[model samples]
Target: MSMTVNPASVVDEGEFTVRRTIRIDAPLEKVWAAVTQPELISRWFGITRFTGASGAARVGALGTITWPEREPVPVRVEAVDAPHRVSYRWCNPCLGEPVPTEIDEAHSTVFTFTLEPVTDGTQLTVVETGFETTSDPAADLESHRGGWDGELDKLVALLESGS
Candidate 1:
């Protein structure tokens, strides 16, 4: 099934935030697993250290995700509500290998994914904030804006293809 990829909306709120919402032709449970389970996440996003354990993304769970052709970006789980919401803090710009430390306050952002069951599928929304704390807000915001767009598209493709 073909679908229109949603474009990420970049907003400058003192700092900046990139938000995107996409509808997947899948159930909430399936969508949630895709976002929360490391095995599934890696298929569309990046390679993560998470072991796909349930309730493993609680606050303080720290790990690194390395996307293809990109450096390993440090991440720390901030909040999670199974099958519904998951939020994490990670390096924003991801400029180079090793992001100094886990979600540095001065160079990181918090990204949250929310899932809701819809009539024909699940609605997934991703909001990445905290750019105000980064060294270069504008550049990081723009880069992430494009990044989320592509990543989310990969997610939709992964789910729709039933792979």
Candidate 2:
């Protein structure tokens, strides 16, 4: 005998917004610490160092970003409902040409991570949205997709290693 439960019948539509879920073998608090702390930023984000005085586990905190490819970009704290949600916009000079003053679509694009409590540990979902591209978009998402995946893996490794 065979029976099937249609996935749509059971899953919440909002839960389906996530395209990826990474399970790390760490508690929710531990995971949140790594994601929010400025001093610990480089351990996962590939940044050389992070500087944000108010960003040390606080809402409405901002950070200065530094990657190998370009200069440090300013990131304002959009929202920081911590141990569960952290939302912020990130734009590098490398993301594209600076948006014209009247058309600043380039700035609002963001990386938002939502964490949910789970049985073993935590389920971290990182969503990079506002990519709304008009052309030559294949490489951008391709780059970001793998980049986020790898970063997630690194985050898991860092947390699991008890660092």
lDDT of each: 0.79, 0.60
For residues 111-155, could you state the per-residue lDDT of candidate 1 as single tens digits? 999999998789999999988877777777888888888889998
Model 1 off-target regions past 4 Å? Answer: 13-15, 51-56, 94-98
**lDDT (Cα, 0-100) at 36 in candidate 2:** 79
Q: What would the TM-scores of all predictions be?
A: 0.88, 0.72
**Which candidate's TM-score is highest?**
1
lDDT of 2 by residue, 69-100 (tens): 65566565567886799876655333665522
Among residues 3 or more apart in sequence or in different chains, the pairs in candidate 1 whose N, CA or C atoms overlap within 3 Å are: none
Model 1 Cα shift for residue 119 (angstroms): 1.0
Scored against the true structure, residue 136 in model 2 reaches a CA lDDT of 32
Predicted candidate 1: what Cα RMSD to the true structure? 2.3
Top lDDT: which candidate number? 1
